[model samples]
Target: MGRNVRKRRSPLAVRAIAASAALAIGGGGLVWANFYASAHEENSSPNTTKAATAQVATISCPDVGQKLTNVPNKARGEVDGELATLDQQITAAYQRLATTRDAQTRDASFVQNAILGPLKNNRSVIIDRIKLEISRVGGNAPSSLDGLSSCTGTPASQTNAGWGNNGQNNGGQNNGGTASPAPSPSASASAGGQQGGGQQTGNGGQAGNGPLAADFVDITKVQANVPRKARTRAGGSTGTFTTSCGVNANKKFNTDNVIVAPGVSNGAHHLHDYVGNQSNDAFANNDTFAAAKTTCANQGDKSTYYWPVVRIQNGTQDFDQNNDGGGKEGNVGQIQQVKQAQIKFVGSAKSQVVAMPKFLRIITGDAKTTTNGLANANAHWSCTGFENKVQLTQQYPICPRGSTVVRTFAFQSCWDGVNIDSANHRTHVAFADAQGNCGNGFKAIPQLTMRLVYGFRAPTLQNGQIKNAYAVDGFPEQLHKAATDHDDFINVFDDNLMNKMVNCINKGQRCK
Candidate 1:
């Protein structure tokens, strides 16, 4: 269902206010030192000048929503609205930053004085509202929230660089850090492309935001790196339950996130491809979900499953080419239809899983991992044939001829056995440890692993430019980094089907 549209400021007026220090900002690249240093130092060395003048790529703000873990149930609705407002503030600020590049070049303190300062003040006010909402509901608001109001600039260089495994294991899968023989110099030369730039360029596809050539790697060069298998316990549930939900062939798409920003239009700031439950939108509640029609083969499995839509940036524009959360927000190109979507639920390696509570909301992977760091990043990118041998966390794999691109999401399986959702939308669900063991007080639930395959021509790197680049839709500030890939799920299975799924998993028998 289409979302209820909310009134928005005129784009021109919003930009004017943003340029005049009235709007809050998010996204990266606005280093004060680099601007001041480059403007004043004429005698600096070539390298010094280059380093000192690197462009601000996007805005980076402390994720305030992630820090709020204790808001009372009664206060959650108000707090969620405020959090969405904060996101809006950042988006506006980033819009200012993106539009005022010339002004920033002319005035060294333009970003600090007009954008970041106003953004901090705006965020501080929003945080205060959150605190007040909690306090009104007899909840103790954490004092540390005040510290999250400030924002920073991420340099263009940092955003384009490949991210390494920051040592966190992702649901017992490969951490994406295994070493292999280096590519030959000639091979490296051919694969290597220009770094991301500030302004729109042929190399940095979507409105100069990205899907940079450097963001891709030749999959054949990666070594076999899947980790050693951890032994399953004697009584471990060893089977799987598969659900056949056709890919979004009906083109079900939206930018609203009902789980995190309910009732807010275009809250995700990116397009999402939805399967199962056809009635998902920001206004959807438990009753709406229960009554919705499903695309799954079994009518009992009405759970909503969605992820960011992947696009091929081959100079083609989609229907949303001129609308918010699409081309207007730097997410351009034609949306690729998924060739196959495999949804499987498997039991734990340690014990049998209990049934997940109906309406349980689970979000796997961090959608802002580029700026938020790798603490919660769970992206897995690979080619069809190389899935077992190599999985990439940061780089998009350049598959060989006849092989398609694949994205996998292994969702959190350990539930806290309490609330259906949490204040931050993540605390109620947890991923099993590397040994597939659920933590104390947490019960194992069916682990959903969604494997989506796309049949598109692999983008080529030639003459230092990308030919048919593709990337997941994301917040404009995230620049389409691979690590920002994520998936969302809400359980709405009919009781009988859910029970059947749990039993199928625990009995170690494959069922469809």
Candidate 2:
């Protein structure tokens, strides 16, 4: 509601309290329990610890320092321009998300403090009245709805865009260039009622990273799981891939298959800028998975499943064939953009990665700013060292010396095993990060993929594209809550205090 100028912070500052202080908002109602009380954090009992240990693994990326050509060509300009576009898209998503949060706040406030009170005293009467109201409102229970198991919510088999195990891939082409109809008022009533009357307590949205949680194979696992024949390009059969990230592998000599060049001087560049780097032989010719692992290892820790990912697409084609449950597909669609790569991380969490690719684009500059990839173009994460370059995803360099670098106050974090509700049946890795905690290395997470798609899709739809399309759809609801909450937190959240909290998570003290 109130306005404040957003600025980027140092990586260390974001990592300082990224674990505990990070707050996420979802439609089931804003509750802090889901973010903090996750499976990864609490290790109270020996039994739980053993169970948790089974889910964690450590792998090495010895190729971390691999060097690639570090040419100073103007192509980097094109990449930066593309990245700027993505930033605009992402910024737009955040804005839309803010709007959704406001609506949700109003909607939720209406439900919790307004509608809920009148129904509290007379339980049976309320249920009867509500049921009648639902019928009158055209949200009647189906003829076959009677005697159904509470879990099934229907008496007989029903057909819909059911979210089964392969829900991710199924939502394909659902974004067919045309703006899908916003749910009708009746449907909205049904969704709202489901959020309210039904067992509003389930794992639907709570699942790790939404839909992609279960199918999320570690980048190390992607590299490790390579079939003997699949690893060799000679087979050229376009080997079958078992992992989700492997969807990008296939037979193409595309960026998914390329590697980061070895050497510290290969100076990190935005994955978006890699096409230019590759043209100059600055991009590594090593295997793609190998480079990803190497980048992960260099960041410290050997856990293959924890590394954060930064994804970018070159156009409007679906880079990832397997959406599973995650509604991330095609180039930048209506609900989400940068599919699988916008994720940024802090601390020693880079080990969980699996695989990623690079994307290329063309960026023509304005009157004064030219798309000339000069060394001093004033790009964020534009430093001489490789370390400086790797942080490109987080920092946005100001184009002109006197102009402002559009900073954003957005953050996303995810953990394994936390479920939102029953209907939201999917493993979820929560998305949490905020400009407020940017100083903790918000820009330090190594980006892994930059893809090229072939069409133009609205980025706003991509951010809010819930798979069910029936229950949870649109950005205005959840995004609004998250932004408002974050804005409030930034205004009041003490940086020093948050730093201490993050230190506790890092030291494993907070979890213990």
Candidate 3:
């Protein structure tokens, strides 16, 4: 069990590479600094100061990410389909184990019951079917699940004290009034300024002269009378079911500070928090999950909700470099912790509702994405009413005055009615329309809509100097130029609570 308990660390190069992006949080959002990849010469002399210099970058999975192509349609429908489903389930369990390992108590029980158990069952079924279908067909089957595309944890130990202190130099721009002219969103992403050492960087941090650039767009730009966009409607024969869950705002960020890698190893690559579900983190259990009081308006609901811990990135706040205990007072970065998630549920109107299965898991965006390019970035940034308009240029958005800063999350609501989940953690359910309505042939569950509202705080003044603080903590230094920031939801709901919620959806009642 302790074979992989070692604390993993990111290389000085990777962290240096990520931190090089001095995201211009002010007007125009990102002001990405360039990381120059060091050239490796064959005759280069061995140096004792390797950690301080050029090092080969380490990728998390050298054997994963294989997609079956050109297979016979029969195998595709029979073997490949089952394999894909198993892959999704495995990834979900992996994510749970990863998060659970990082959870406050390192709840091995939940890892066993909620995560590993289901993973084994699903994988076993998949392997048996794959063997039969492949033997029957004339083509080769994938040799292993390792070749599957995955959405679990990265070997964060592949990171380092966040790229390097080069961000400190980029931080100089904040102090200097001659900050480079905020470039057009199009031009801000080129080599971005250069990193001091030979290190490559990702896409994020651009210059914006406007008073509002930030990674997460706040509602500051919100007009008093700006109308909310109506939720998408399919406009079919089915009537829609709705659930407007209140924001458990003011919830506490528990002691779960560090992110664990695939095997549930103690990892320091990024940080996160757990709330709402009292049984979150490593200590999570069905009993605790069922017993834990919820902030949702529904009394008996219990679900483990977690996301990267938010940090006030004033003056290069380090990741939660330290902790007290019990997941309390653990902010080593001296940042503000976000307290709540504003939630809304969208469901299909025509189909009968069904109870949400226990242990349903989904990750909405990729937090481990590199800062390499913007086209593939999914940082999902936008402001209130402007949600449809994604700003890939700015890591964050400066809200218009009078509007609230909002981070939104929408989960797939359509269920396949059989498998509670799929290999992608998404295939089993489908989204309705852009307006949050569901389609036919699937039972409507609450269309999970979550918005995080924040009042941006300027960098804090500390030690006679203003510290540059980020709104969230422990993100991949690059933020994948776009999809670096994301959110997670785990259905740890009590059976009774889930059934009641299901009933509400089936009855087409306005539920809270």
Candidate 4:
């Protein structure tokens, strides 16, 4: 794979494209697809209408911007040392992300867990250190170095530049030196700016005033959903070869729920529905989870069902839970539903759709909570009676014969070809092929397809969670889990991504 250094861009725009560009490399196979971010030009545009991320992510440090000129020389040295070390660690992480061979390590999750998490912890430690210093010598504690968490990627050159414009110049710059790896004969580096010279200071990498990206997860290339290998009866490209379940008849609601995307809040930081025992929190709790009511027909089967909570926005521009927040993005109109989903085995697409991996967690939407949350395009719709075709609209198909009402939601199964989990539930997993096959450089774990077959009558308020309401088991604050809501799936069978879940998807056979 070729590597190129890109100029720092807006966090939202960069993440939107990176998340979209992640390619699915399944078992020695590379699913080919064009990856491009329209926001590339907007990154440097001084005249664009786009609102700079600075306006959105105002990471404020307490107003301690005082003239350290009068502070004791010893105190200044101590503060400088602490700041330099912390900056180096954070910079190194971005450097590693920019050049890590293991695709799994090059994301926001890795940045958080392996990089930012530790970096932030260090920040806490320094705050304590600063307090002690101030206690020893009566003076204000410094907080100017508190804004390193947010940033768009920058070249290693700029990152290693001299000491940043902090209140004190303690001498020496802790440069992470995050530059692109050696390019292949075909793969080049630094397409736009001076390639060798890291002189251009952007973001915190340089001491200049460039704002850091709010998000660091590499959302560059969303994997490919190449058409299923087995064509429809026509045996032609025009034919459809997809599957579906559930009678999802309408786009009911789209309110921010607490469950759907956990950890990093999606702007509003709402919760989402999570089935199984594996909740997407930062820590990996016990895999064995308590059981709950399921919509599936098979009794005793307690697989998890996760989705965004929906609410009926009251037309009144006014605001309330029952009524969708008028003019709000999380309102019903903003909800993005899953477009294509299926349950297939964990092998090559040429083979039969087998069982899924046990304890596999698949997140559908971008949990970053940006306005373009649905840009990832993980949503795919289809019906149960018809395996040869797929549907995009909420309009459910009338079942002929004894076919079931299945709402199919296929989650990304392509691991960095490595890690099972990442900071952002997604960076570790990319969507597999329509047939559940992953592309090259990616290992194919058991791809999970949630065929939410709904034989029961649709609730007046169709919440997708345990009850007809949008709230989870304990949280009574939600209004309803209706149609306009979103859906996410997690397998709590085990710790591994591939295991017994394979047997669950009885390829071609109508399963419960």
Model 4 misplaced stretches (Cα beyond 4 Å)? 1-268, 271-284, 287-300, 314-348, 352-357, 367-375, 380-408, 416-418, 433-437, 450-486, 494-509
Model 4 lDDT at residue 181: 20
Per-residue accuracy of model 4 over 1-512 as CA lDDT, tens digit each: 11111122333542342233232000010001011111232232121111111101111111111212233433543443333223223222323333332343234344335433443454455456645665577776444434422223222232212312111111111011111222121111111110012222111111111112210101112122123343322211121122222222233222232222121122122333333333233222223232333333333334455554322111111232233221211122122233332433333343333233334445553322111112342332223544444332112233334553344445554666444344224455665554434456665444455554434222121111111111111011111111112455544333222222343332332232
Writing each residue's lDDT as its tens digit, candidate 3 over 1-512 gives: 01112222333432232233111010001111112222332221110001111211212221121233234434433442343233233222222322332331334243335433343343444455655665577766556643332222222223222322111111011111111222233332221111112222222111100111222323233223222343433432222333333343544454331111221212223455555665454334344455676655565556656665554422223433443221112222343444345555544534454666675655554433332222112223445555544322234444454443455555556666665434234455665543434555665566566666655543322221222324443322333222355566767666776666666655555555
Candidate 2: Cα lDDT at 396: 17
In candidate 1, list every pair of residues with a backbone clash: 25-93, 27-58, 27-59, 28-58, 28-59, 29-56, 29-57, 29-58
Candidate number that wins on lDDT, 1 or 2 = 1
* Top of the candidates by lDDT: 1
| Superior candidate under TM-score, 1 versus 3 | 1
The Cα error of candidate 4 at residue 484, in Å, is: 12
Q: Point out where model 1 deviates above 4 Å.
A: 1-21, 26-54, 157-163, 166-174, 177-203
lDDT of 2 by residue, 223-342 (tens): 111111112122111111111221122211121111111111111111111211112222332232222331121222111211111221111213332331122211121222112212
Which 10 successive residues of model 4 have the least lDDT summed? 24-33
Q: CA lDDT of each candidate?
A: 0.73, 0.19, 0.37, 0.29
The deviation in Å at residue 61 for candidate 1 is 1.3
lDDT value, candidate 4, whole model = 0.29
TM-score of each: 0.87, 0.19, 0.51, 0.35
**Candidate order (TM-score):** 1, 3, 4, 2
As for TM-score, the candidate ahead, 3 or 4, is: 3
Clash number for model 4?
78
